[model samples]
Target: MNPHNARIEHHPVLGTLPPRKTIRFRFDEMIYEAKEGETVAAALLANGVRTLRLQEEKGTPRGFYCNIGHCFECRVTVNGKQGTRACLTLVEDMMEVISGKPFSSPLKKGGNHA
Candidate 1:
């Protein structure tokens, strides 16, 4: 589904959102459009992207959880910098975001046991 389809243009409580300039950003080498001033996590969710990163130890998928920046589940690499919180970072035109990968953990099955 497209971001437009996933976005909530109207809400009963907040009502319809005002028109905002559309901006383009890259995520995982894929380009997507988002409203100006939108957070990376919000834009990703609007584009039907759920998996933000993988758990460092288990290599399990992670997405937007506890979006208030308290939990680092939405961490992603922005502009070549790692550990940027997707829920807190704003999308910029031509910005590049890369999904984070799990680090090698000895606790993981089949992982290096040294």
Candidate 2:
């Protein structure tokens, strides 16, 4: 099962899982399908997208770490807003999820573009 292009077919304990309603969303200009109500981070991981963003100073790759909202490691740009936490934000149809780089800059706050 290549997660990069398809959804999970089966799980060890859960067995074969039923397909959920899928929605279309964009990641950096490429369109991807994700289950409705799933977090951006979850969807990304499902699609084998680990690196959500990169660190500013060092340009280190960043991906989903905590899976929860605490760490903020899974930050991405939704629409035009910056610093959007992928783990906390649910997937929406037609939503533009940009793989923002450096996560957040020390210079900006409140809005996207950092």
Candidate 3:
């Protein structure tokens, strides 16, 4: 576990969270450990990885602003796919996470979904 991780080690109401199976994954070329069933955002946060992506225009740093999937603040590249929502995507062993400038979006080129 990261020394500066922000994950909830102990909850006031639920007490300590039970240990879960561990998995190894990579984020921006660095390996990180995460619970098998946990979300990519949760795993990144647990490992002190705050900057999930950067603004395309100015390259401003962004991270987990909203825990849910609404904010789009935690968007990242998973494997070779871009615009993957980290908060809703489950972590898998050996998964590759690319953050910041490497992350891309189809909308950036005014592409239409339909």
Candidate 4:
């Protein structure tokens, strides 16, 4: 193996990547500006919203592990609902997002409602 040959990929789907655009979203009561074509989860992660979900046991911090939706780690409330796959959701201006307890977090860190 050639150590010097190693190259890091910015995206898993390298090549033919589309240009990013600007979009807006509302998490809780605050609005956030993000790029278009970016996954809701990805944008959230980039915006420092690492704590996405709440732990069922004691409201511990839960964050995304897999960018893919199969992990269910990025599950969040979208437009007032539960089981939303943030990684799969696209950003649309005025989109509403919430974290914890399907709408309210018993241990919400940022005052997010259930």
Candidate lDDT (C-alpha), each: 0.91, 0.81, 0.86, 0.73
Ranking by lDDT: 1, 3, 2, 4
Q: What ranges in model 4 sit over 4 Å off?
A: 1-19, 102-114
Better of 1 and 2 by lDDT: 1
Clashes of each: 0, 2, 0, 5
Candidate 1 lDDT over 1-114, as tens digits, reads 363448888999999999999999999989998999899999999988999999887789999989989999999999999999999999999999999898876475667788
For every model shown, what is its TM-score relative to the native structure?
0.88, 0.76, 0.82, 0.69
Report the error of model 1 at residue 78, Å: 0.3
Tens-place lDDT per residue, model 4, 20-58, is 666789886777767777778877866668888777656
Question: Model 4 has how many clashing residue pairs?
Answer: 5
Error of 1 at 8 (Å): 1.1
Order candidates by TM-score, high to low.
1, 3, 2, 4
lDDT of 4: 0.73
Considering every candidate listed, which one attains the maximal lDDT? 1
| Residue 61 displacement in candidate 3 (angstroms) | 0.5
In the range 1-114, model 2's lDDT, one tens digit per residue, is 334754566989999967788888889887778888788888888887879988875688988788988897877889899899999999999899987665355655556764
User: Model 4 compared with the native: what TM-score?
Assistant: 0.69
Stretches > 4 Å off in candidate 2: 1-18, 103-114
Q: What are the RMSD figures for all models against the true structure? A: 2.9, 6.6, 5.2, 9.6
